[model samples]
Target: MPKKVPIRKCVGCQERKEKRELIRIVRSPEGEFSVDPTGKKPGRGAYICPKLECLEKAIKNKGLERSFKTAVDDELKELLRQKVTSYEK
Candidate 1:
């Protein structure tokens, strides 16, 4: 039998989903926050769906802040917006 894959929670919808189906946002040791396409970064992390709408929902509901336990700056929001746009393209 095939092993069941692990699922992760999306801060946006507060739902659990397959890890491979979501994008990972990571905080580096130096306190930098960025999207980790490779999902191999070493630091605190949060998962979200790759869809732009999911990102909007996450930001509007303060889900990212709740997951990271830190306020996300406007600059980071802009960066995330751009990243999600690129992902959608």
Candidate 2:
């Protein structure tokens, strides 16, 4: 039997995709947010596709803020942008 693949929805595109195909953004208990490439980090997580358009959409629609349930400052948003852009390289 083939292994069942985990599925997650992208906050940006609202599309269902395999977990491995999305980047995970995790918010620690201490309220620190970071990208989790391994998808094993503790705390709340939000998934987004590895594309700039998705990232922009997520930002514009406040998807991350809704997922994290906290205000995301501009600095953090810029940091996330950097991380997402790095993944494109």
Candidate 3:
């Protein structure tokens, strides 16, 4: 029998996918928002695809804000845009 892979829900599409296939956005213990490539950061976390489209969907739908239970400022959205765009390339 093969071992089952873990799945996580994407905050963007709200769909379940393999955990390794998604990017993690974390809110640190200090209440800071940032992307965690390592996926080991402390505090609240949200998952999304590395694709720019997914990030756009999440941003437009306020998925991150709901996940973090806080407002997502424009600065964070800009940072996320740059990061996801770079990742897609």
Number of the top lDDT candidate: 2
Candidates' TM-scores?
A: 0.89, 0.94, 0.89
lDDT of each residue in 1-89, candidate 1, tens digit only: 99999899988888899998888999888889998988899989999887788889999999999888888999988888888788787
TM-score of 2: 0.94
Q: Candidate 1, residue 32: CA error in Å?
A: 0.6
CA deviation > 4 Å runs, candidate 2: none
lDDT of each: 0.89, 0.92, 0.89
Task: Name the candidate, 1 or 2, with the larger TM-score value.
Answer: 2
Clashes (N, CA, C under 3 Å) per candidate: 0, 0, 0
Q: Which lDDT tens digits does candidate 3 get at residues 34-85?
A: 9888888899999998788888899889999999999988998898889888
Clashing pairs in 2: none
Candidate 2 least-lDDT 10 residues: 72-81
List runs of model 3 lying over 4 Å from the truth: none
| Candidate that beats the other on lDDT, 2 or 3, i.e. the better one | 2
Residue by residue across 1-89, what tens digits does model 2's lDDT show?
99999999999999999999999999999998888989999999999998899989999999999999998888878887898898889
Cα displacement (Å) at residue 21, model 3: 1.1
